[model samples]
Target: MNNTKDFAKSSWIALVLIVLLNSCGSAVKSTPPPLRSQAEVVSVGQDKVEDSVEKKLENVKIGDAQAYYYYQLAVLSLASGNIEEAVDSFYNAIKLDDKSPFLHTELGKALARKGDLSKAKEACEKALGLDPSYLPARTLLAAVYSGLNEKEEAIKEYEKIIELNPREVQPYILLASLYKERKEYDKALGVLNRWIGRHQNSEVGFYHMGQIYLEMKDYEQAARSFEKAIEENGDFIQGYSALGALYENQKQYQKAAETYERALKVLGDDPRVLDRLLRIYTQLKDYNKALAYAEKLKDMSPEDEEIDVDIGVIYYESKQYGEAEKLFRGYLDEHPENIEVRAYLAATLEENQKYDEALKEWEKVLEQDPKSFDTRIRIGMLLSEQGKHDQAIKMFEKTLELFPDRIRSYILLGASYNQAKRYEEGLQVLQKGLAVNEKDPALLATLNFHIGVSLERLGRFEEALTTFKKVVELDDKHSNAHNYIGYMLAEKGIRLDEALVEIQKALELEPDNGAYIDSLGWVYYQKGMIDEAIRELERAVSLIDDDPVIHEHLGDAYTKKGLFQKAVSAYEKSMKLKPENEEQVQKKLEEARVKLKSQITTHTTGR
Candidate 1:
């Protein structure tokens, strides 16, 4: 059975202001004044000038002095970080001068800072209604809409800001971000392009463009944009990080490592940069370099115990299993109650071939937390490995009881039964697993494969064939399923040609598989290609010398070629290897001996 684990993994701009006023008035005394001479006209003109000055003073007094005072107070409060006071002052200012969009916009900002987004939005909308082209109001409204999750409204406000001031880069950036959040990649790119076109030297714009391209899965353009971002501003740490990630995603480990190394040189041992370097080095299998960076990370964040586990895993992956074991063991010595650390230690012990020690560690883990399904599964696997099938079965059963939906437990239980040669029990367990998760393709494929093995072992040839076919239908890449069907057909002496095709396909998938090679040889023998059969069977035996079945097949091929002496030698080897087939192999050996004696006698008589 396949032990498949499914791991589910805004800108603003200022504009010029122009005020125009028109006044028209007529007085009855104006006709009398027109009759006056130059001197009289001069006197009247002086009076008229004084009257105009008095009217200007009255207009100034009529202006909202209280509103201007409150607006100034709001600005001062905002600058002093008194958001509540700022909001109150701005509200008072707006009440005095309700037509002032700027005052309204300021109120919106203060309200937004105070976390009253709905009121903030209302104030911003009021500002926009008074002066739709007011950049500050539009900017505030966009941000308010974004805070309220009204993305389309936010986009509209941002667009208006851009229209008011195309040179403003913040709006473009904010709009692009909103587009990206909405998954409108093309629109996001369009906005970023506008920003880049306007400000060619903007490293931030290039970096944002790179992010957008990365989200769209345009890796080439993303890489190019990131490169440009770093080129424009070599000190851009985020640019380096993003570029390294892109390389890593494409499996370009060398480039990723180099990018992170460069970042470290510029960034000077930043923990995040060091971690990336460690991961990249690990992927490249440069364990020495990986360990160096990992050490740096540990030093940088010594209190993070997870870093210790990461270091241990790196050591294990690098084949320094003993070192890995010692590291985890050291951690467990201090944190004995840490189940995760203990589990890693157990795995390290298992990898080092200390199965008994590993089993003790797993038991300790279970003692701490009995509901750890992963630990229980590991213990069961260890027991099965030690040939304690009954104990393993109990553990697996207990796991199923605790987590009825854990498909892995069912697979392990069925597989343990298969290993124990309890074919019936294996079949029943796998069928039950299938019933639990009928639609999970991996589980279905695994259960069917095991069921096929059990049915074949129970001498139910037709059922076994059907099961194997079902397995293939579920997972055509199941190489073992292909080999089993081919070998079964060859053994039954039917469909030899089809069997050859199937086995060849299996061999193509796993060219070095001895079982598949043996199946191919058996198919050839059934097809009466004695020489080909002998060649393939010999190769199969060379690949897997301990398999008595391959030896038996080889002997049969030799017997078919009338090479009785070779046949006798092959049969003798098969019998020595597996005495359970002695009865049949002995009869074959006797026939080969008799045939050899008859041939020798016939040759002697003819001479």
Candidate 2:
């Protein structure tokens, strides 16, 4: 075993932090035979004992001295943890001196170690009958009763020990532990409180009380108890740990941070304490503080992957995306098999708008774990935003295959199809979504709106209008339903007044919506309120300068008002911007040319 004194000298703080205190009022030392009590001297006369035994055996050894030899054998074997050999020796001893309580108790312990509980109990009872004051026999008997799940008998034996020796802390500690384990919390607290009163100076009592209070969720009391424990024994690292944890559980981050910071002061440079401080800083959203502590811990324990991840998290949470990505990448370079960190790095890249780089990272994650539904879903969402709807759809479908119960994937795929203008396909996807959750107003509205758009594309205005009405019914404030249905009606020059109402309602819900404003202007134009149409269209055009449809409406309104020069200007602007609509642009350009020619011809004839 490593030298405990050397380990303690190297890091005294680590010694205190690692010394797990038992309820029995003793600290576990960093040595072999872990938490056992100080060794009791079973015998101290090895030379004298050997000489006396040899002298006693001289005459019998030449012929037979089985019982005497077995007694000696049992003592040697028991010391070596050789339970079988000790049992054999104890059997021989018992055959010679059947009333020997010590031999019977030794046999009982060996039987218990060998998992012969019934036989062990019999041996303990026999030892107790021989000598009722044998503490080891009684203790072992209690263990036997416990193993048999005879709780009353176990408690009686433990109580008897307590009555016999009230000053000895083991029985009280053991009894309190049993009560705590059974979740008879009040009873456990009572026993522990009595123990503290008896051993008032012992930090063990206060520490155990704090643990019980913590389990009871009385954080305030637990913290106070821990503080008292620390006050009594400043070297009690566990007191500081529990106090810090109490503050953290209350979400009093500043207090938690302060408590953890204090723990560091008490237990200096402990890696576990430093790691906890890092988390406390994170909870406070003070990532810079977290990073500062994390760097220290990383230097202390360079190979700790969890600390590396913590540093990466601090950077990510602070919005230092580039630095976070670099850390994660470096970590993955060494821990290439760490799928979680790889995935996080990919997410960070995506957040930075580095789509291509992000995709590479994501692909690596998928290579390692092809069945990751979450990663597949993220890939789909990213591709959809980049306008690669086909690839996005495939990714979403794959995610659904992995997690068929994921409702959001279906919703996303439907929206992606709609963005691609495959309205029929979009409607089909949304219909399936509705089947999954029919009463979901948002999903119903989506399905109806897409169905309406599909019908509108096919020039079935009546069917489209009915579908749009259903969408509005499902979600009275569905913005797209109002705009699409209203715009279609305005374009057809039917229900122009009703179309204006729907468009106005849409604009009310989304006042900054240029599309709804354009719809309102178009309705006014269809109703032949040319001046009103000009004002609204000009506002819509200003708000949505890149919308070809708004520019087209503005140009047409100008043409209708006999502002031929302005009309030509608006049409030219629209034509330049809407280069994809070659047929419409050509028609608008011809109309502007005709208007310009008519104005010139009239001016010349008048002159």
Best by TM-score: 1
Kindly give the stretch of ten consecutive residues in candidate 2 with the minimal lDDT sum. 13-22
Superposing all C-alpha atoms, what RMSD in Å does each candidate have to the true structure?
A: 16.0, 10.1
Best candidate according to lDDT: 1
Q: Over the stretch 1-607, how does candidate 1's per-residue lDDT look in tens digits?
A: 3222111001111000000011101111100111244344434433443344434334432149898777667656655567688788878877889998767876776666566778877987898799887777777777667766677888988888778777656677779988998899989988988877766566777888998998888999999998988897788777888899899999999989889888988889998888888888888888889899888888888888778878997999888889898889878778888888888888888988999999999999999998988889999999998999999999988988898886777788888888888989988987888767457776688888988999999999999999999988988888999899999999999988878888988988999998898998899999998899999999999999988888889999999998988999999899889756789989999999999899898889984
**Backbone clash total, candidate 2:** 0
What is the C-alpha local distance difference test score of candidate 2?
0.74
**CA shift at 49, candidate 1, in angstroms?**
51
Residue 122 shift from truth in candidate 2, angstroms: 2.6
Tell me the TM-score of model 1.
0.73
Q: How many clashes does each candidate structure show, in the order listed? A: 4, 0
What lDDT does the true structure give each of the candidates? Answer: 0.79, 0.74
